[model samples]
Target chain A: MPAIEVRNLVKRFGSIVAVNGISLEIEYGEIFALLGPNGAGKTTTISILATLLKPTSGEAKINGYDVVKEAAKVRQSIGIVFQDPSLDDRLTARENLDIHGRLYHMSREERQRRIEEVLEMVELLDRADSIVKTFSGGMRRRLEIARGLMHKPKVLFLDEPTLGLDPQTRRHIWEYVEKLRDEGVTVLLTTHYMEEADYLADRIAIIDAGKIVAEGSPSELKDSVGGDIIKIKCSDAENMLKKLVSNGYDAMLVDDEIVIKAKEAEKMIPKIFAIADEEIKSITYKEPSLEDVFIHYTGKVFRDEEVDEIEASKMKWRMRR
Target chain B: MEDEKMISDIYAIYLREILRLWRQKVRLVTMIMMPLLWLGVIGNAFNSVMNLPTQGDFLSFLTPGILVMTMVFTATISGITTVFDREFGFLKEMLVTPIKRESILIGKMLGGVTQAVLQGILILILAIFMGVKFSGAMSIPGMFLTMFLVSIAFVSLGLAVASKITSMEGFQMVMNFMIQPMIFLSGAFYPTTFLPDWLKIMVKINPLTYGVDAMRYFAIGVNEFNIIADLLILLIFSITMILIGGHFFRKS
Candidate 1:
């Protein structure tokens, strides 16, 4: 059996069908990415497979144990790092691991050893006894990741693992994630960051609105849209879209930029740049971003809206224990 | 497999919760205040205003009810912390673990109930100084038994309500809607005999009414309701509330 299997999974919250019917299978010892925007159901799908959620209909299995019937077995095999930070600020990093270890029934000696290993793995050994509340956002996130791994779960789920971190910490987590994969753990994560996915994912499934729009290796997904991407920056892309189509070129208008695919960037550069003329202040060319691919399939990434203050307010709590 | 893990996890989580609350300054204030307010303020204020039958004094008869009511309120509001955890993703963090989901609520219940009951017990002692007398009516052990039963039943009722509400604001609103109503309607502040007929009927449906009635009867020799009937009804109320709380906790 595949290491993880989700078949025709569905989840609903009252009138909101958060996850439509979707299916996926992941092999052992591979790092797979579920790429999507806020409401894409990637987190919902992972939650079901992690045994944290029950599917409205259909089935999910982890290491051959049914998520519904054999949820205990599924949970034993999987570790989840949620989209938000879950560390207890009051506890020291070591204490956090110790508490989780106790939950898994780890012996005193065994848990102590595991704490050292995890702290070292996250490169936080020096700060192991420090309170988590005092730690930086990046450090807290890493501690959460370390705590998730204390049980030695075979399948690991990272839901937006590097979210809300600076690029430096994001890179640091990416390296640790690489180390886990090298150790033969099946790692699954959801990200909107194209570079993060391209740098780490063995295969990526592009999800949107509770459905998989595309699934393949990074190169394969990019290749699916045809050739290397050529972006034409202009004051207005509306007139340019008409110009490119009238000229028999399939160019997609993405905001102020026109993205087109061609066999060779060298030859297509002139024709694409000609459409913009003096209107083009400058032009640069790269292969394609998962963002580009997202735009290729969907309309826009709307990255600005992703970080609105409304999403931040959702994180507030009561006594904050 | 899940059940065993859940039970053990509940124990661990409950222990942690109790430890945290014991360390909290504000929680310490509230737990002590609820009982102190009754013994020092409410009990003293109504010392001679309302004439009620008491074995020794009004404060003595009123102490047990306030103790149980405090436990009931504390236990019910315990879910508010869990709601805070849920809203902040701490509860979700605990739930996603391979451990039993039932353990989450169970741990909260155990810790919350323990604190509440202990608080009530502390108040019971203070009541002695407040002119309330214990005639050694029942053995020390029997008094312990009575306290245990009352605490468990009321605490369970609190957990049942807390688990159903999601937000802290919503939880507080519902607690006000249900708790004060239960308190007045159940004779936590006054005697059930003083209540009219229709209210007396509603009192029968409330676990607190039966719990306080049995508690008062345990302290004094009077019985507005049959002692045997009250004890049996308390057991029923305790079990049913536990089941209901467990259901909503799992739903959560």
Candidate 2:
């Protein structure tokens, strides 16, 4: 049996179905990614597996123990890094680790030993005594990961590990996660970043509207959608879109660029250029991306970049008294 | 299989919970000291300023009220920390840990309970120095037991409120709406004997009234209600809230 097996798991929060009867198995030691847009049930599904939320129906098991029935056992088996940072800024890292250790009934010596090991793993050994508030976003995320690893979990679930980070900080995190992959720990990660999912995950499930739209390896999902991507950039994209489709070619206007998906992009590109009498600016054939695959399945962008600016600004509100 | 420890398990978390209040030591100092002031400043302020009818003196009558109130505010305002933790994601971290979920509840409740007792007792000691007389006062052990039950009831109330709140804003809103009204309604500062007949019936239902009345009843031989009934009601409320609060808390 696989390390993590979710069978027809459905978690509904009132009227909204967060995990709409989705099911998949995460093999032991494999870095599997659940790729989805926000509110697509990725986090909800992860929460169920982590035993944070009980399913409305169906069952999920980790190492053969039911997540709902054997929650303590499931909790013992999995380490989860929630989307939010889960560290006390006032407390030193070592102290945080110690408390968690005590809760799990770890002896003083064993807890101390593991604390040192995890701190070193995240390369925060030097800063272990410092309060978490002093650490940067990337460092705090690393500590969150370290904290999750305090117990050697069978699977580590990271929900959008690099969602709100700079590219450089994100890359640093990517390398750290890669190190975990090498250590033979089965990693189940949810990510909005196409490249992050494609680069790290061995197998990927594309979920949308609380359901799995597609499931395969990175290359497989892209290839399953389009054999090759024929790229074309022109000033009159709308006109170009009309002419290409009128010529019976399956061409999609992706934001500013025109993507023509076909068996052979080399064969399709010349025909596309010949058909369009608009501003022929630039044309280059290229490989497909997870973004393209997502757009192929769902008409909208992978992440609605049009997130409400006001809702995003509320994180800085003075903590309630 | 042997290497799995929980998230950020630290000894300092308990210390940190203490220190979080310690940095704002004014609240801790004020929680206890304010009650002590009632024994001295307020106790004497009324001693000369106005004459209040009681069996012994106003200080003895007021002391138990202040002490129970001390515990009440200590437990009720503790919803603030719960709100703060929700904002900072500290509470969420504790919830998902593999260890017993009850530890998070226990650690937090114990801290609030400790703060309330130490603060209330500090004021009680101040009352002792102020020469406030105690007629029916039990031994030191009996006094400690009374404080424990009262403090536990208060802490349980705070836990109950903390568990349902999602955001700090919601927690604070509820705390302000529920906790303050509870404090004023519980006879923390005034005697319920002065209350109207209908209001007195509500006060009879209010656990704080029983706690304050009973605690004073023990300390200085005041009030007419059975002390055993008061203690039993408060104990039931404490246990019921702890179970309900702890249940919702683990899920949240």
Candidate 3:
């Protein structure tokens, strides 16, 4: 059996069908990423698989245990790091891990030993005795990750693990996640960061509006869009687009820039200047990224959800905790 | 072995609440300070102006009433923490664990009862300094027993209300509207015998009235209602409230 299997899962919140008939299978010892923008149902799907929310229809299994029927076994097999911080602010880092260990019914000696190991794995041994309220945003997030690993779960779920963090901290979290995968732990993570999926995930699924638009390895997904992207910054982009298309070239205009797809962009670059004359100011060509693939499948740029002031403050409050 | 671990899980939740109460200075200070002001200012104001029922001073007669009121207030505050946990997402962490659901509510209810009883005892000790004696009508253990039962009932009552609300502000509004009327109808500040017929009927319907009546009998050897009947009423109220609270907690 696959390590994790989700078959036609559907979750509806009144009139809103957050997750609609999505299916996925993740093999053992694989680091899988569900890549999508906010409100794409990645979190909702993970919640159903983790047994935090029951599906309205269909089924999911973690380590061969049914998520809804054998929820206790599923809960015992999987660990989760939620999008929001879940650490108790008043407790020290060690105490928080200790409580989690107790809940999982780890013996006293094993609890003590595993707590130290997980703390060191997150590089938080020095601050283990301090209360969580005194830690920085990055430190608290690392501590939450450490707490989630205290139970030694077979499968781990990370929902937006490095959201709202600096570049250095995001890189730091990526190393620990890679280390977990190296130790043969199956990890399922959700994120919108294109570079993160490219750098870490062994397999990627691009989801939009509660459905998977495409699923493959990073290079495979990018290769699906076909050919290098050549973007020219010039005046009269609309006129240039029409000229290139009439000449049997796939070209389009995007925000004052003319873009074209070609198998050999090097040879195409000189031919493009012949049509432009003096209208071209600059030109650049690069391989298509996962972002381009997303646009290719959806026919639209990724539109980020707007965060209201109350939601922003709630995030700030959690970071403080 | 599984049973032992389950007990430890409950202990972890209980200790978490205790640590929170210790770190939160404002909650502890208010829990201690509220009863003192009530016993000092309100107890003194009624002493010289009003007639009393007990054989001693008005302060002595008012001590048990103050203890019961403190328990009720502290129990309500205890339940509000559940709403806070839900609002902040900490409750979700606890819910996703492998432990049983009933243990979560039981652990929380026990923590609330412990805090409420501790606050009630603190006031009882303070009352001794104001010349109220514990040996008046019941043994020291008897007074504590009555306090424990009343504390459990109120904590469960608070949990029942907390389970229905989602916000801290909303819980406070509901508590404010519910607590004052319960206090007045319990006859904490006056005797029910001298009241008019309708008011007496209101006191009879209030569950807290039996708790106060029982505590009054234990604290001063005086009975407004039968001792067995009062204790039974409080027992039935506690079980009913816990069932209601547990049902709502499972729904959430």
Candidate 4:
């Protein structure tokens, strides 16, 4: 059995279907990423699988235990670092991890040993005695990650692990996440950063508007955009797009530039110049990126707006409380 | 084994609250000072206007009420910590743990109760220092028992209200609207006998009325209702409030 199995999971909050029929299977020791813009249902899917929210339909299992029926067993096997800061800032780093250990029923000696190990793993042993309120944002994130690993869970879910961090801190967190895979731990993370997914994920599922638009390895997803992307800025771009389409080239007019998807763009460029009657201002071609892959599947550019629709929905949920 | 784990989980949550309380130095000073002010200022200020049907002084009559007031105030506002936890995201960390959700609620309620009872004891000591008389050494256990019952009931009620209130401002508004009426109507300031019948009905319905009356019986050798009846009503109130609070907490 897969380490994590989600079968057509659907979670609805009244009229809003937050998670719309999602399915996934993750094997042991692999780092998987759910790449999406905010409100793309990545966090909702993770919440369902972590047994924090009940699904409207379908099912999920962690370590072969049903998320709803065997939720206790599932909880025992999984650790989660939520998108928002969840540590009690008043407590010291060691205290926070100690609380997590006690919650998981670790013995006193085992908790002491594991606390040192996890804190050292996150390079926070020197700051273990310092109160979390005094730590910087990056340090807090690292401590939260350490606390999540306190119980030695089989699967760790990191929801926006390095969100709101500097480039150096983000890289440091990525390295720690990569280290988890070497320890034979399965990791499922969600992020909007294309490079984050590209650099760390063994496989990725590009989700949008509560649906998975595409899924593959980073290179495979880039390759799925069909080979190379060729953009030509030219006079009479409309005429150039018409000429390329009539000549059976896969082309589209984007912002006064003609974009073409061709395998061997260098060879296709000579043919394009031969066919085009319009004056070409400039021409550029490069291999497809994950951005290109996202645009290819969704037909829209990725917007990095800070307004999180999931947080808005959560506010509504809290209001209903 | 499951039961053992649940106990340890509850202990962890309970320990965190204790640690947080210890860290709030200002709150400790206020806890000690507030009772002194109430017993020293209000106990004397009200003595002139207040007349009791019993032989004891007004200060002695007011001591038990003040004790109950300490417990009620501390326990009820203790739920504000829950609202703060929710706002700051720490509650989510606790909720996702492997332990049963009810363990979290129980742990928090017990934590609030511990704080309340400790405050009540501090007030009791202050009341004695202010020349308030008690029945004897044996009354100490009954007084502690009454304080515990009052603490548990109000803490559960506070948490129940908190489970539905998402914001600290909203909770403060509701608590302000609820707490003062519960305190004033419970005969914490004056005797319930001289009040008009309609006002007496409100006093009869207040849970703190029984708790204060029971404590009064132990502290001042005075009895408004049967001690057995008072204890029974407080017991029933505590259990009912706990169930209601636990239900709301689990739902959230």
lDDT top scorer: 4
Model 1 per-residue lDDT tens digits across residues B110-131: 7877876677678777777776
Model 1 per-residue lDDT at A76 = 75
How many steric overlaps are in each model, in order?
A: 1, 18, 0, 0
Descending-lDDT candidate ranking? 4, 3, 1, 2
The reply for model 4, stretches above 4 Å from the true place, is A234-237, A254-257, A270-282, A306-321, B47-53
- List, residue by residue over A85-165, the lDDT tens digit for candidate 2: 777777788877776666666687898899999899889999998877678878888998888888777889998888667
Interface RMSD of 4: 0.7
> Candidate 2, which segments miss by more than 4 Å at Cα?
A225-227, A235-250, A255-257, A262-271, A307-321, B1-26, B51-57, B100-107, B133-135, B164-206, B221-252
Tell me the deviation in Å of residue A254 in model 2: 3.5
TM-scores for the candidates: 0.86, 0.85, 0.94, 0.93
Q: Largest TM-score belongs to which candidate?
A: 3
lDDT of 3: 0.85
Docking class of 4: high
lDDT of each: 0.77, 0.76, 0.85, 0.87
List the candidate 1 regions with Cα displacement exceeding 4 Å: A7-23, A56-59, A88-95, A124-136, A220-227, A234-250, A271-281, A297-321, B1-6, B44-54, B128-132, B185-207, B220-225
lDDT of 2 by residue, B84-148 (tens): 68767777676666655555666677777777777777877777887866666563665677778
lDDT of 4 by residue, A94-164 (tens): 99999999999999999999999999989999999998888877888889888889999999999989876
Report iRMS values in order: 1.9, 4.2, 1.1, 0.7
lDDT of 3 by residue, B66-143 (tens): 888889989877976887787667898898899888888888888998998889888887887776766546557767
lDDT per residue for candidate 3 within A71-188, as digits (tens), equals: 9999999889988888888889998898888888888899999989999999999998898889987898888888878898888999989887789999999998988875677899
lDDT of 4: 0.87
For model 2 the local lDDT of residue B250 reads 66
Each model's TM-score for chain A is 0.90, 0.90, 0.93, 0.92
lDDT of 2: 0.76
